[model samples]
Target: MLSIDYQQLLAPIQQFLQCETPVTWLDVAQQPAQLPILLTDHLICELKAAQSAMYLIRRYAVDEQSGEALLQWLKPYEDFTYRQQGDWRALADIKLKKSMIPKADSGFGQELIDKMVLLIKEELHHFYQVLEVMQQYKVPYDKISSSRYAKGLLRHVSTFEPNALVDKLICGAYIEARSCERFAKLAPLLPADIGAFYLSLLRSEARHYQDYLQLAEQIAGDAISERVAFFGKVEAELINAADTDFKFHSGQPLAFSAAVGA
Candidate 1:
């Protein structure tokens, strides 16, 4: 029932990313038996996305008090996800108020807080939504190993200050863009409800990537095309290379069929 211009939404994402999600990955992802692993990994990815945004805000924008508050806001999700000690139903009521985050004095601090706050909210909510979907489908969560996709990109980050932050942001952009692109391409091949849910994420995922790029450029005070392109190649290599771990952000599957629904 969702209606939007798919072509227009995905055009920039397609352009930003150097390569598409492999047919082999999509083929494995859409298999009916892979639901548990897909949903579980997706749940973790959402929490991880929120955590990344929180890290950025705490590191670059917010005061210590604000950072701790942000952690408290996300603690329930972490407990449920990692510690396995919470009622998922209660998550719906756990919310972060705008007033809770006290701004600090930093270059582009307000902007970073604003955009990352938005991204954190959405990612957390999407985490809840994924849990809801899993509950409906009776998919149990699982603790799985991390994939090399993110580490591959992070390995090349500069050791310097501004460059380190900028590199991370560019990597963030590539990650978000790739996620959006994959969601779009995989939606139609899945069940209707799941497909719609995946498609629904297109707008925010697209915006998150753009916001990362904008913030990176603002912090860099110069064009980041060269660095962005470098991360683009790195991200593409991770996406295209053979990967053994099958997680939400995993690369091409090597022997992941038996590991499905982890």
Candidate 2:
């Protein structure tokens, strides 16, 4: 069990989420055999988070050359995750390399670069941490299809400029909030070392959720409460409804027999 007040850490996230994770999902997550799949998905989630943050910065904040540098910095990890050609050791040097991010004239641009660069750094570090845990446990990394959770939320993104950006940031907030909430939920059920690691991640994840929300509100330049509520409902439905697959963010697990029968 974690020695910290996890509920206190998660209070804000819990308030942000419209619904709690389903009991059925929690039941399945507690099983010992689910660890490999959980950790593998978690490892990928970290990379995806970093990649998303990088894209936001590249598309809105940085110059073309800086964008290329960002891609190069992420290339080794991506190669390993996607192509399975590179070793984990190749990711070590990436942590030390810093890319230049030129300041943009627009306030939103500079703000995005500032916040997202720090987010990218932390997420990449977390990815490495997940990989370390996976290696220790002999959990091989394999590409798995993404959970329906994110795609469901993203389908609501507006196909325009600032609205698109604002909606994406809102989605980012929900994703991070859910991730933090799930970590707190899962930590106690995991073994000592893994539990401690998950607990260690809470502080950063909390900050990330806040960062995304702040950026969304700032970019929107008005009350985003309604839009936030809209996405909250969408996110809650995804969390609460029945789901067939057992991903880190998947809903209630479909019974094996049910799947076989289908």
What TM-score goes with each of the models? 0.94, 0.93
lDDT per residue as tens, model 2, 1-262: 4444877778889999999987778777877788898999998899999999998988878788888889988888889999997778668777525555655565788778888988988998999999999988888888898899889999999999889999999999999999998998888888889988998999999999999999999999999999999999999999988888888888777673254347
lDDT, each prediction: 0.86, 0.87
* Total clashes for model 1: 0
TM-score of 1: 0.94
lDDT of 2 at 243: 88
- Model 1, residue pairs in steric clash: none
* True-vs-predicted CA distance for residue 58, candidate 2, Å: 1.0
* Overall local distance difference test of candidate 1: 0.86
Candidate 2 TM-score, C-alpha based: 0.93
Best by lDDT: 2
Clashes of each: 0, 0
Query: 160, model 2: CA deviation in Å?
Result: 1.2
Could you tell me which 10 consecutive residues in candidate 2 have the lowest summed lDDT?
Answer: 252-261
